[model samples]
Target: MLAIINDDLAGAGRPESIFISWLLWQPRGVDLASEALKEVQKLARYEKVDPDIARLKALFASLAGSDRSMH
Candidate 1:
């Protein structure tokens, strides 16, 4: 998933822990602690949703379903 550190993600003097909140709401946000693979500040500057993020959400949903095959 492409991670973008736009203004929303980075507030003025925003604590690092804030990322935890974002991840909590978005279960697909994996590997957030590592160095960002992609940072499109401009791309996320005007919008809230990004393509990579949407795909990640879909991927996470599939993974969740895969884990529940026993039922």
Candidate 2:
């Protein structure tokens, strides 16, 4: 998790790609990114922002550790 977050914050595109690769390799770790995406999207709207845009932004922020609260 930390590694992925770090990669994202570093603006490395590989983490996102690598995550999918990890899924292909392990095939069972629960690719939690999807759920994370949904939850963060909800948070965005709950915070009174546009849900779709906020969701994407938050997901990117998440991948990049731009969001400080994911931990």
lDDT of 1 at 33: 31
Kindly report which residue stretches of model 1 are placed more than 4 angstroms away from their true locations once superposed.
1-48, 66-71
User: For model 1, which pairs clash?
Assistant: none
**Each model's C-alpha lDDT?**
0.36, 0.46
Model 2 regions more than 4 Å off: 1-28, 48-71
- Cα deviation in Å at residue 31, candidate 2? 0.9
Per-prediction backbone clash count? 0, 2
Ten-residue segment with the worst summed lDDT in candidate 1? 34-43
* Residue 57 shift from truth in candidate 2, angstroms: 9.6
Residue 23 lDDT (model 2): 40
lDDT by residue (1-71, candidate 1, tens digit) is 23444466444223233333445655475664322222222223323365544333333333344322111
Models 1 onward score TM values of 0.27, 0.28
